[model samples]
Target: MRFMTTSDKPENATGGESAADDTAEVTGIAAQDWDRASADPQYRAAVVDLLGALAYGELAAFERLAEDAKLAPTLVDKAELAKMAAAEFHHFERLAGRLTEIGEEPTRAMEPFVDALDGFHKQTAPSDWLEGLVKAYVGDSIASDFYREVAAHLDSDTRGLVLAVLDDTGHAGFAVEKVRAAIDEDPRVGGRLALWARRLMGEALSQSQRVVADRDALSTMLVGGVADGFDLAEVGRMFSRITEAHTKRMAALGLAA
Candidate 1:
């Protein structure tokens, strides 16, 4: 993924910075560029909130996938899940660094999202390996789509960062293949997995609404508030696009959306 610019150590760099931070500073464009681009307070706040939410979401996904890896029936399956978990962690580290470079405390930026994300995970905990796979595929796809949609409204640098981190590293195909093969072997399992996917979607939508309500700036930007702001009709159309994508993904998994 392409990053913006590389910069020297922030004169205030603490020895405690992680390797991800070091790598980001070396590869990323100078922080001053981001600061200048986000001159508008509202735009800056929305961008910060968006990055924070994404950062926290990736971190939570990493933890959840790692836990689900234990449910894999075979060593091969476990290894695949572990790879996905690692990918999520890599995305999280990139996002965290971007947050810091933009002058936001990564932890503080992510803190507000903890409850919303954690609650969604708790509510949609998988019952078995199949359910977990479906959750990973459907849930992550929805998130990636949503971020991609929002990225269109962002400045070039921020949009590049968002799109880059959202790259799924081909894990969606892995999940879809595993789930579809399992269903083919046991026809009845498809019904159960289909129902689980629906439940995941519902829980995700609920949590997303909660996040929007809690983050005014981010919500505004999402609904077209960044420049001219999106009208209700356009927002409806935007959601329709998201729903259409979800339907196609579900069909790929041989499940109903």
Candidate 2:
């Protein structure tokens, strides 16, 4: 997947007039700009927390992908992962820059999320190249789905940035192709990957809940204290959607969900 580099500039979050209008309509923000929406300190805090979590996620993804590359069986695979790692780092830069633009220090913003995310990586460390690929695809997608659910309720600018940064980093298709090929070569691999994916699913969901629970602003935003936040019913439905997507991705990878 193509991605921005250091020379590339960030998108103008303010320029997506039609898209922003649609999001604003859905979220009941009525086209409120970030300036107006951020007037509320709680909402601003939520945005900061959201950006912080996402920035750190991208940075971690970059690191993980680079390390996973060392396990590649071929030079082509290594190069491919390197490219993807660069893309993830590019995404991190965008998020970090956005945090700075919004008057928050990037490192400080990401600090609160470091322990949770790092602990997740430690607990769910993959044993090999295939497992690493599975982790990147399954684990990252779950996080993206959760963020997308929350993004639906955010103001236009923040929503746009969140969605943009969550773009696929060539991992989904790459993982599916590599994993299915492996399973085809030895069908027993399917069972192993299936189990690995299930473990990733549980851990990812747990971390997601933990992160939100630890952040009052984020939790409040998700549970309806902020702009058009989800009610309890919708929160349940959101997880259902995320799980459904996970099942589909696992099928694509030739693994049971």
Candidate 3:
């Protein structure tokens, strides 16, 4: 999928996007030159695919985190979650600035993956603090990993912006404490949490496939120019790192990993 930045309705550019079905035109600001890759269609497409995905991801993650904050046990904990959630919006604003600098509306740039990315959040909505941490720990780790991959292929300025939003430890301590306490109250919670973790991995993997297939440029950037080039080895490495981190956090909470 070639995603060219459009301040004008991108999804409605040719009426082929699923969103185009509802509105004949996305109808927003005029298209501008928001990308450094404008000199080449493939390059432009690649950058837009990266930014579009990143933008939508930030927007969606913020909303999910904000809602999930309500699951916290105390007002202080809730405020911490809210604070972390606000970081996503700050990221959105930073990304939107870049999009506008190059001449694309943030909303229009993010419209393409509206369904797939948003769908992942809706289906994987957290029910409580543990689930919320699973969402943050597992979800943020993978997203940051992917961003690191694509950012490597870009110029320093753009890449720095991308790298700046990597996995945040913003509320990991609180989450760890909460998860540990819950498990301590009921030892059986360990089994349920492990199972829940597996389910999270499954759903995340499924959604990742959708993202890889939907945006070829993104896939290329991730896999060093081959669509399926990044195999189990790379993913296993990410899994191992995240798992180790989770294990340590769990141990800190007196929960056996």
Lowest summed lDDT window (length 10), candidate 1: 1-10
TM-score of candidate 2 to 2 decimals: 0.87
User: What is the full ranking by lDDT, best candidate first?
Assistant: 2, 1, 3
Stretches of model 1 off by over 4 angstroms after superposition: 1-33, 226-230
Q: In model 2, where is the ten-residue run with the lowest total lDDT?
A: 1-10
List TM-score per model, in order. Answer: 0.84, 0.87, 0.73
Relative to the true structure, how large is the alpha-carbon lDDT of every model?
0.77, 0.79, 0.64
* RMSD to native, candidate 1: 9.9
Off by over 4 Å in 2: 1-27, 226-230
Highest lDDT: give the candidate number: 2
lDDT digits (tens) for residues 1-257 of candidate 1: 11221113233221221112434332322232455537657667888999899999999999999999999999998998899899999999999999988789999999989999999999998988889989988888889988887766566688789999988677798988888898799989888888888888889889988988888787776765333343455467667888899888888888877
What tens digits encode model 2's per-residue C-alpha lDDT throughout 1-257?
01111111223122221234333212333245688677767777888998998899999999999999999999999999999999999999999999999999999999999988998899898999999999999878888888877776676688798889888888888988999899999999999989999998888778877887799887776654333344566567768888999999898778989
Evaluate candidate 2 by giving its C-alpha RMSD to the native, one decimal: 7.7
Residue 11 of model 2, lDDT score: 30
